[model samples]
Target chain A: MKKHHLRIPGPTEVPEQVLRAMQAPMINHRGEEFTSLFKKVSEEIKEVFQTKNDVLVFPSAGTGAMEAAIANLFSPGDLIVSFSCGVFGDRFADIAEAFGARVERIKVEWGRPVTYEIVRERISKDTKKEIKGVLFTHNETSTGVLNDIKSLREAVGDHPALVIVDAISSLGAVELNTDEWQIDVVVAGSQKALMIPPGLGLVSVSERAWKAVEDSKMPKYYWNFKNAKKSLEKGETPYTPAVSLVYALEESLKQIFDEGLENIIMRHKLLAKALREGLKNLGFRLFAQDSWASPTVTAVDISDFQGKINFSKALKNRFNITVAGGQEKLKGKIIRIGHVGYVDELDIINVLSAIEMILADEELFGKGVKAAEKVFNEGVEV
Target chain B: MKKHHLRIPGPTEVPEQVLRAMQAPMINHRGEEFTSLFKKVSEEIKEVFQTKNDVLVFPSAGTGAMEAAIANLFSPGDLIVSFSCGVFGDRFADIAEAFGARVERIKVEWGRPVTYEIVRERISKDTKKEIKGVLFTHNETSTGVLNDIKSLREAVGDHPALVIVDAISSLGAVELNTDEWQIDVVVAGSQKALMIPPGLGLVSVSERAWKAVEDSKMPKYYWNFKNAKKSLEKGETPYTPAVSLVYALEESLKQIFDEGLENIIMRHKLLAKALREGLKNLGFRLFAQDSWASPTVTAVDISDFQGKINFSKALKNRFNITVAGGQEKLKGKIIRIGHVGYVDELDIINVLSAIEMILADEELFGKGVKAAEKVFNEGVEV
Candidate 1:
């Protein structure tokens, strides 16, 4: 079989230019050239985050940025409200618990977006202002759901708790107004919608979070926002950054700005609609609620396969098509097809045809690739 | 001016193979293909680390691994012995303190190595068992000094305190016996002697350090040893790894193993000695003491230039030779030339001639590039 197309959530397919940008000659971290590069990149990153406050860049995955947000925002034993819908959400609770924080999870079912009412209820229960923060994933990739962070923040009015959103898979693919949503800490990675590799984690902070940093008792060094902010003031990193990746990011962000934020989000939305409609017409059920579905990934319930159709395994082994499987309780019950950055209608049609052929080969579906091709042709026009 | 040769501590010149490796198609984090890839890479990383213990891969610089070490080892109000000789040593102290660890520093002058005598004195003074751990940098890149870690470990004797070593700049370039030296925690990064770009950081833990992880109370999520270990058991990262970097690391490790670790270390030593001898023959003053000089980098006083030469800046501007400047208080005083991974006699000569040209350009020294060429020819057998 030929090399499989990557249709999973992230490390998303990086554009060729971004890859070439990383191939540039290395620079000394302390040199004037690097300082200028870092400063421009840092300032440009703020435009994407839509925040005037400091944005710390780390050389880890989105998870590392999540850890940094927790480490730099609160002391040990501080009460934190974690909104849970899927694996990433649960991860926040686990991270907070490991850090000695009392994590109160406002749980929602997997594939379902967490309502603002639950968050409000959790905050109201903490009358003593002991809840230092509320943690939420803006986009839950595992479940293909996007939480309404704007409404959640509005619901959290007058509360002393800071709102932290994990925008790992959604940042560039969706509309994320960090300042508008009053997101105290919004964390993202270079992978996913940013159309780059998975090494760089970014966290944009608000003034409120900066104040919390002063009193945070957790131990942090490499991911220290304070040190990063100070060095950023001089257009540098406290230590040698992932210089190659930083160079790649500079190029990626340039493309992002050129496409414009609204246009990017609209592209994802339109692509997501096309994918969902195609799957539905082929008798598949989407995992996420219609209103809350994520534009990045579309998780479809594939339980109706009649014969020997192992949908997830078949796509990979037969067609060299790499898609995601169900996580935790949903394992083997769903297949997540991605339509993220650097992907277009042609790519989507190809993936859809691959899936169609596999399903027909197993004697589960008979319409073949024509339905997917028609959908793509129609979808591209819109 | 042409592009500067990155001959400082890290973010070294990436080999073409490693760069090509990073050009692979991105895989979804939750996909079956990634799981297979993740497992293969994780096990291979273990082979490089030479540990049965899980190796956690992070996407930051070496500092991220250092932060991971701090967050996973000690808790608030815990006392730890920190040995300081250079900027990285100073960093360990800062990180420990940031995590609420009471750091007692055994200070050594910059450009000097820490002696067992100092370690013994510090260990003897902590009679109350208040010291929770000791942090040391295996090769202080800033000073071009290597400490006697085994001797320091012997000084600790039966102490319960953990021994952590920051082996960032030394790992692939210098010989390190993490298991044999009773090092509780050892940290390294990809960009230094590893001949890869600056994205991944690696850490290995002894059984003793694993036990200390249970007592660690600092806030952690992405860097959580427990979570990473759990995922590593299945040959996957807890979160999305920098997949492309891991691919690069896999190729890098193959080269390292093919050359053999001992040979790699020996090559570094021979090159370092030859560089020093050539500098000495050229009437250059060595900043680091002979006994404690690092095999990776050679720090020189450049006192002969007095106020006449800005060695670091001049070399970069004139010949695109990027040597390291004196950091912190050592600024404008010393020039550090690193001959680490993928380096040969030619690279040494290239740097040496650049230095000689800079000196001659200022008329501080006679035309020494030709003399240095002869000295390199005689001194370096490689």
Candidate 2:
């Protein structure tokens, strides 16, 4: 049996320490032991989110956090501008539509980020300020594109509408100043960049979002923001949280703070560049343009293989590197290599060397690895 | 440092093998490895539920699963009969009400089960068949009462309204025949008798529940049963599940099947009875009537102490055993001792001995322990 390499967009490689922390015997969630830990985590996660507002933790997947953003902030028939470019972006829009919101979808091309002007133009057209909110996916992992949310927020231009960002795959490994950007809500999860498994869905709420939440009439229970906030006041969650995951989060937040956010961000950026540059050097075309390419995941157009090799299968079966296939319309057309969370430059080099081995004909033995090493050498300050 | 004993109702003591399994590295959730594991767990969980129906595994706490049932089965203003006996029962009713259901709550007194006559009387009044569903908490751990669900189902008596049971704290430790009892939905959690940490909300859905899910007008995304069912068809989840918890569950379920469900139930019953008798021998009064006493958690009236000792604090401060105090109306009136998941005869004995030490009056030194030993010796056929 070969050793496995997890390179999926999420459910990424959890740190060894975090896993050990999770294995610590269960504790009473309602007691002081959990409350003290909860308060500390509640305080520390704010640094990662770069927000002073409350961060609501839920025992759910990242998509569930995105749904919480929709459920809490707006009522049915509210006008919401949904920015769509990738699978997760569409999923957010779908959740909004399901809640009976009038979603004016600004459809961006796959593998492309939505420009500030596009958001400004849409908000400008809502003459009466009828639009209640805008949903944005900061990082579209499916298409390996990261939207410039700080610029997009500026595009709203003093509109009373709330601004929500789905930063599930981007928050920790990327630079997201939630308060500085004036983001009303930022949704994230444990799987990506948090260096833990996928259970805890962390959503940050600004004063602006809470104001909207006060009057929203959506039928809700499990994701009710007010109930969660009340419990947090006592350092408790409204319901039973995933206790083991929270333990993992405490240790993970420690590791994240230890690394320092800026260095972590740089490490992700350099690793992504190494992977993309290495793949490009091997004649594989990159899916997203270099300008808006995600710092976490990179997509490679599968046409370069000429159907001679199933990249995902070969990587898994032979190399033991579990890269991802594209989703929805991009299925079978591209391969997505994720370098989020606990991934390092060496992991990228290992993947590249294996890819070279799989696609070797002649003169390609060390081409990809050489290109990756060059990028890592020229870059990577931390 | 004193050794810690987690004795809360849930987030119970996870077994060593399960903890070891969770420490295994994360894997690609979309890959064959996870899919095979998903299929295996899905199939095995039905045995635990004793149902032939599809069990939708959600990455959430027990309350979240209750929310799923309410969101998927009934629309706004749908009539639902909620039977409330304790905190969790009231919580189930609150969830229904939050979803805009016209909840007709049958309030059974705390420390007592909802009698079959009460259920029959409630259903008998709904001659128009307007009652869409009846929510039942099979075990009211908050009050240490176990409602007889099989008899209660007979009270429903061919009524078309769906019967949903919250078997969160009772399922793995008690006998529950979901299909045989004709329950439309059964909600459970990982932390209780499953011998794993919290994070997973396991729900079994009958064919009838699926039909209601199709026609229900409630808006849902994260807890959408249809989406979960579709993903299960391909041996995947609608979103990234708590992958590590599922690993724990796979191992835990293996241990559960090896122990046999009947044997597990007997172990729980004996432990609860031994603990109750031991406490009673020391002049402590069990809150619930002996007839309906829960086989998981037991509530002892605080009055038994004559206000001489703080039982919960003393237990923790001295022995490091974390027992829960009462909730809401019962707060300061009772002490809840959780004897669920991974508990055996010795755990009960240790707790009894600690209580005896805390209330040592020389004459009471080994009274509780002796009474507990007598119960264990005579009982515990398994």
Candidate 3:
């Protein structure tokens, strides 16, 4: 039996050092040791978030932070503009609606990126200043599409409405400037680009978003941004934080900062480029548009498979590898291989080799191993 | 420097094996690898929770699930019964109020156990049937008191109100039967007795609680128990769970079951007994009632040193050991030495030895080291 490896996008692979850092004994949250650690980690998280504004670290998944951003920033019946491209995008809309906020969705095709025109049209059409916020996903992991955040920010220029960006998948993996992009509320998770386990939700808030938080009337408690901010002022969390995960995150971010954010982005871009080229060389067409393809994951159209062959399930069954399947409507039609986090050229080669075998079994590849070798040799220009 | 150890209760020592388990590469949440892992973890968690019901795991702290238990089971304006014994108990009330619940708190003295008499009085008084649930903490870590949950259940026998327990610190350390205890909802965390890192909030629901959730009108999204239950049925989470924590928890639970729940409780009891005897021999007095003393932690009264010393901060600074100080009005007035989770005779002896030095410094210990030796020799019966 072969040991399983994670080739999935968001969770990527955790480094041994990061995991070791998390093995520290638990400390009292309100105690002095944790207070110092809490303060330092809060500051370091802000640095990674690329914002001087206070970042609220909740011991929750990205979705929890997404819900917190919504519940604490809007009132019932308030309008929120959400762009939908895939599962997570739809989730934002569904969650906001679930909170009683009327969501105006700018629907984009599945596996397609949200362009500036769509957001511009949505914002411009709002004659009333009723839209409290415009929600966007920086990277649609379900479809592997990266929306133009800068363009969305430009379109919402000077609008009083908050610009909430779900950067759960893109944060450290891609080049994002929450400050420069004018993103009001940018949310990320630990398991993604930070190369840690899933547990912490990092939400960076701007002064503009803080104002909305003060007046927002939605019912909230545990994920209350106001309470979290109040604790942040004292460099603490009102509740017990995941100390080990925070330790892991601190180490992971140290690695990220030491490598320099630019280098981290370049590493991911290089890996993404290599994976895409390798897959294409094996006769696979990318599911996402070339210009908007996510550096974190590449979704390929494996629709040529017979009904019996679900490319997503085949990788797990035959190769002891796990990749994401198309969510909702695209289920079983595509296989998404994520090359984000601590992945490198060698990991890409290994994944591609497995893909080569799976595709060959479906008669979709000729000279399967040779094709992967050609792509690996020519793909990454290190 | 001495190696860091967590004698401060939760976020207790995460075992190396559990740490190694989480160090495995991150798997995609939607992928098959995670699906199987998620399924097994969910089942195992149910076993720990002692319920056949689904347990929803959240990325946030235990407070997140406590809040979830409230928000999902009742709507805004819904009246609920809350018991306030210490900081955490009151926090639940505060959060419920914040979420718009009309909370009726049964106030108990700090450091005092809540009685069945008080619960009966409160329930009998609420003849209006407006009370949707009764919220209480099983272990009040702030004051080292464990409420009589068994009697409290009898007091509310056959009542329509649900019983919710915040077993964050007590769950695996204490004997809690979610089914037999008639506990309608029980919320716990991955830290504490679970011996994992902080990040996951595990909530076990009773069939009765599910009915309340069905009609619950409170505004909720990420903490929605319905979404969690639905996804849990399919062996997945509604959102990306704290994946690595789940893996660590799986390993931790195996250790727990291997030790057996009854024996685990006995170990905690014996350790608490040793710690109390050690402190008493050191010329220190226990704070909470002896009968109600928590097995997880022993809170010591240092009120005698009011103007003489700030032993709270001194212990951590001088010895690099972390213990908790009294919360709220009891600040600097008491110190808590937690002897729970991966702790043994040596840990209790170390804490006792440190207390002797600190006490001698303040002239509180007339015999110093000799006093501690007597306690260490008692050797916790187990």
The candidate that wins on TM-score is: 2
Per-residue lDDT over A122-237 for candidate 3, one digit per residue giving the tens place of the 0 to 100 score: 78877777788999999999999999899988988777889999999999878788997788999999888889999899899999888988899999999898889889778789
Which docking band does candidate 2 fall into? Answer: incorrect
Each candidate's fnat, listed in order, reads 0.00, 0.00, 0.00
Residue A358 error for model 1, in Å? 0.5
Instruction: Kindly report the docking quality category of candidate 3.
Output: incorrect
lDDT of 1 at A76: 94
lDDT of 1 at B322: 83
For model 1, how does the per-residue alpha-carbon lDDT over B1-382 read when each residue is reduced to its tens digit? Answer: 0323678877787765777888788888777877787777777766656567767888788889999999998898899889989999999899989988888887898878888888888888878878899998889988899988888888888878899999889887776777777788889999888889888888898888988899899999978999988887776777778888877887888777787887788778767876776677567889897788998998998756768888887877755678888888777778889888867544664565456545453332212323333433343253
Pairs of residues at least 3 apart in sequence or in different chains that clash in candidate 1: A4-A320, A59-B59, A59-B60, A99-B219, A219-B99
Clashing pairs in 2: none
Cα TM-score per model: 0.50, 0.52, 0.50
Model 1 residue B52 lDDT?
Answer: 73
lDDT of all predictions, in order shown? Answer: 0.79, 0.87, 0.79
Write the residue-wise lDDT of candidate 1 on A1-382 in tens digits. Answer: 0333688998877876888898889989888988888888888988888888888898898899999999999999999988999999999889999999988877898989988788778777778888899998988988899999898888788898999999999888888899977889999999988888989999998999999999999989988889999988898888878999888889998988887878778778866876776576567788996799998998988777634688777777755668898888888788788878876544554465456555542232212223433443343343
- The sequence of per-residue lDDT tens digits that candidate 3 reaches over residues B100-129 is 999888789988989989998888887777
Candidate 2 CA-lDDT value? 0.87
